[model samples]
Target: MADSVPKASLYYYPPSIWCAAVLLCLEEKGYSEEEIDKKVVDLSKGENYALSFLRLNPKATVPTLVAPLEKTLSAEVESRFKALTETKTIIEFLDKSRSAFSRTNTTSSAPAPALAPATIAFTTVSNSIIDLLHSDEAHPGAARWYNARDEATLAKICPSLQAFFAAKRDAIAASLAESEKGAIQASAKTKKFWEDKSTAASEFAQLFGDGEKPESELSPEAKAKREEYFNTAKLVWETNLRNVLTRLSKEMIGPHALGDQLSLADLHLGAWLARLVTLAGGDISDKGDVAIGKLEKHIGNGFALPKDFQWTPARRDDTSEVKPVVQSKLAAFWDAVRERPSWKKVYANGLH
Candidate 1:
């Protein structure tokens, strides 16, 4: 009976935190990647606005779920294929549509959304964090230093959010090669494709915008503005992130976003925190070095953390030592998340 259930094809971009959350949820719900296709949308080049994509989602947001129409005995439900938008809506669909209920006897049973409290918490806190992370003010700093998050655990945790876009870079290289071969007809498409893969760094400068360029390379004027904007972004995100951590830890009285069990809230918050960790420019090894012997003995998971200098904790605080405290708290939560095997699988196999 379970074999007959419909699966969704998730259309997403590697860098989207919301897409990361949806993926975690999909895995938690026992949907395998084979059952659900992971389609990467190249947003850096304006592919999200591509007319072909617009047909499925006009707004061109990431993490869109497309599923076959379910056959129901009721006239109320539509019979067309479902193209769901938004992480929240898609998650709700995944939760409720687990098994088919006979439409004839629909009134005999009550169908309720699962995890009301967790959903409410996710909507309130995690949603805010995601927005603050993606706000125009924050994207620049994140895109500027996307590579700093390279850690064994992170490489294990967020490949879906990294490799998908890495593939886009490869795609662009191939397209550029095609153009070099004098494919004039494909020139316009390649132009838009390149545009979709670029970040603010590329938009402002003629650079590939891969976050490989050092801040020293930017023009004086651009460098000053970048520093100014990043500082503001740091303050804004730090304030919100600390608030969420407090609520999850001190107020909730458990390791997760709501309580002992993981929920949608954790998925949302974890994805954002993972990004913030990368932007911090330090890895789990930095903290491990402080207690590496003790941590290795205690972890029991047998996964050796990489010892690298790619990650260096960025200073977001100018007046206080609070950043470490917050980072510590966040790491504690990240550790709990890593303990979950399903959570670990999403980041496995080169992010599949």
Candidate 2:
């Protein structure tokens, strides 16, 4: 029995942003890292494609959840896995079906009032984050505003943002080779994703074909494409970045994701932002630096704070590090969320 997996458990990888969200949610529900059985799936070696993992989530994505197999389950629900895929659905499941308020949560309730049960605010903030993801992805041909310029533009920035994509691409390539060595066919999407990422990486490499060479060295067609790609990327990011940030800021209702109550909403938002901003972020210019959408620029350079901004002292357990970025209500909301005890636990030990 000691060697057997828990009847219920969370399987995830540390690098996955969504996993971080779920971990925080579990903590908020009064489940400690030690309390819930957790399985760390190593996607780097393609463990996610293993048949066993595929049984849990066909998509092969991280943060896959496994419900406790129990005899008490209703006949209709018993047959289903309750296996949750993607951060949004996983968070929703935890909030609706498994909440700290509904569970035996003595840990998180005293310091702060137990968060309001998940509400429409969860859907609202979740959707906003997805919108932000679309803007961030900007993948060629997939974006709605399909134009060659945007296509080329995203390609050009791909090189500048190589750190963001290269790690996953390389891992998939390696995983494919390993699968062949082990005589395992791997999962359905495993090979396909590797091929797609390989092509994308090669294209990004080509964009940076001549880091030291002058633009004159390229053919006229190549030069025009490069020029349009990079210039358009710069223009689009610069033009809308501030507006997008302000829009998200205004949408936050309180100190956390939806309102003052620390709900699963904050978990998803904090986990995603922390991964993009604090962990993977390297170059100050890259999108990984969640700071791009933050309000630090407005406050530091002698700019006035937003009139509606709530200026709480940034000093709280782990929140002191988050400091105050009082450019908008949204900024302050996140600032508060980061300091949350559940978030701190997720940060300290949930991953890896």
Candidate 3:
């Protein structure tokens, strides 16, 4: 038997999106970086076997986090970790935990929580968007709405979203500007005030993930540096999303899909495209946004949803017609992405 000491086992493929999403969730849950990284495995080339994975988890999917087996271990430790570590389970665990972590975490001392979990929330939202868009009951109006969400439509929507963020950003800037004006005469509280403000600004920086630039897009040396950075973020972000999405797409859209209800997959796709464009710092051209525009339309128009598709938004105030809890989280995550400077850059470019 293999020794399970000093580490828990995580069977994962580096390129698997679910694996990455799970990893991000773990990080959000206040797990140490060392602990989180230790469990990640890159099984991209068929290294994980069905039996081996089944021994750990019957589901046998990538991103399985298995605790180290030990003789005479207390039931509590075993039960807690075991009960809480699956992808969706872990995601929920982190959602609550990250808030707690943010309250007490002295490691960063930043205004916002470390963004390791933003990616986690991103995956969750994307999954929801994907599920909603594909369901049969998807509102007919959504199709046309999505079609309209094209670059041209975004030219309109982007302005609205941008105006919202710009005002917020400007408020922060003005407050900071006031502080700078009194920097020399600043008192202890004033100094603390400025420090707090600086931390808040950096939160936006931490939340945005920028991968390396392509060699084709840059000169050799710059490309290499950008590539390295991109590789790190991409490996952790995109690669993980790919794994999760593949499983989800096949399971949901494929022939032998999961439960009758439409799920997180559709939301994931919409959120994903939204993030991609945000990351790229541009919106799709008026017509170009068509690729993902359909999804937004479906969401906006109220999907008809299949009879069996039962996950509805949990709240009465939510505009969505799907699972409320999932929708709420997704809405928050999308709000964050849209507010980022990267989003502005992308939206500006979309005008072209």
Candidate 4:
């Protein structure tokens, strides 16, 4: 009978924090990535292993797992996932099957959006800290402190959030080449794509803080080649941010509040919020911006975070730390280089 159980395969994106959240849950459930592919999704040429795996799971989203082993035992085994989607539901199902119904309040009116506060908070703060640290312009004190975090602690106890984002940024960079090429081929469409993306970013800025044009709006040729890809990416980021904030708001004021156990929502929203702030020239405070103020209050009161949520304690002496040079040019070049297939080849070959 044990042989009848299915062998599980997880289909997921390396960089997705939500996927990472699901991964953590799976890890707690004793699943291993050795059981799952570590490949990043290839978005160019419309290729994604995760998408292909969705032949069974039509959702086509990351963090999906399939139980192929069960197919050999029974016809239904092929239909049922080894267990993906709904961490709490899966836990409850397993418990109920064993007559271990502990009368837990497993179900709630809140949408079972996988990116809950705990998941989001860890992903967001960690990513924000990492990104800031990696940036050349990051405050020397901040960078030193972040770098000083024990490597083992970050690897083991930091909850695997870094792995998720690293995988995502790499995947996005890899996929952009195809997206850029496609955009370049369609001049008018590409212009629309960039304009649309810029407009979305502008709106996000306006909503959060500022609506001024980014100084680096694309050039005519580059805009034509890259706008659509950025536009689509911007839209995805926008939706994710909104979803996180809306859920958080509902949780704060409504009956569905995130009681005690904060989730991925906090991290997801926080990261994007930080991004929006960064793009808008670090003006997180809204002047006469009622909506922004309300949102800030909601974030503050809802999460019960420290007043210094954004600050990290310094780990190095002020005099000993050297200010890091901003890598804007190098970072831009790296960003462009990462999109090339050769980059992946080099990575695979351990050449870089």
| RMSD list, candidates in order | 12.1, 7.9, 20.0, 17.5
Q: CA lDDT of 302 in candidate 3?
A: 40
Candidate 4: residue 241 lDDT (0-100): 32
Q: Which candidate gets the maximum lDDT versus the true structure? A: 2
**Which should have the higher lDDT, number 1 or number 4?**
1
Q: Residues 144-260, candidate 3: write the lDDT tens digits.
A: 112222223433433333343334344445545565786434345544544454454333222221112223656565455444543444333333333333334333421112222
Q: Which residue pairs show backbone clashes in model 2?
A: none
| Candidate 1 local lDDT, 1-352, one digit each (tens) | 1333444578897766678778777666554445566899866554665546766885567889887666632345443467899767786666555425312122213332243244565556545544554455444334333322222322232334344455445545555566568753344654564556544323333322322445666787656654554454344444433343334443332345555666555666666555545443434333323333332322223522333212234676797553333223344456567666655765553221
Candidate 1 wrongly placed segments (more than 4 Å):
1-7, 32-35, 43-46, 68-79, 99-202, 206-252, 282-329, 349-352
Clashing residue pair totals per candidate (backbone < 3 A): 12, 0, 54, 20
Model 4 TM-score (2 dp): 0.32
Best-fitting candidate, scored by TM-score: 2
lDDT, candidate 4, residue 274?
Answer: 34
TM-score for each predicted model, relative to the true structure:
0.55, 0.62, 0.32, 0.32
* lDDT accuracy of residue 307 in candidate 4: 21
Residue 210 displacement (Å), model 3: 38
Model 4 worst lDDT window (10 residues): 303-312
Which portions of model 2 show Cα errors greater than 4 Å? 1-6, 42-55, 69-82, 100-171, 174-182, 186-190, 205-236, 239-241, 275-307, 311-327, 348-352
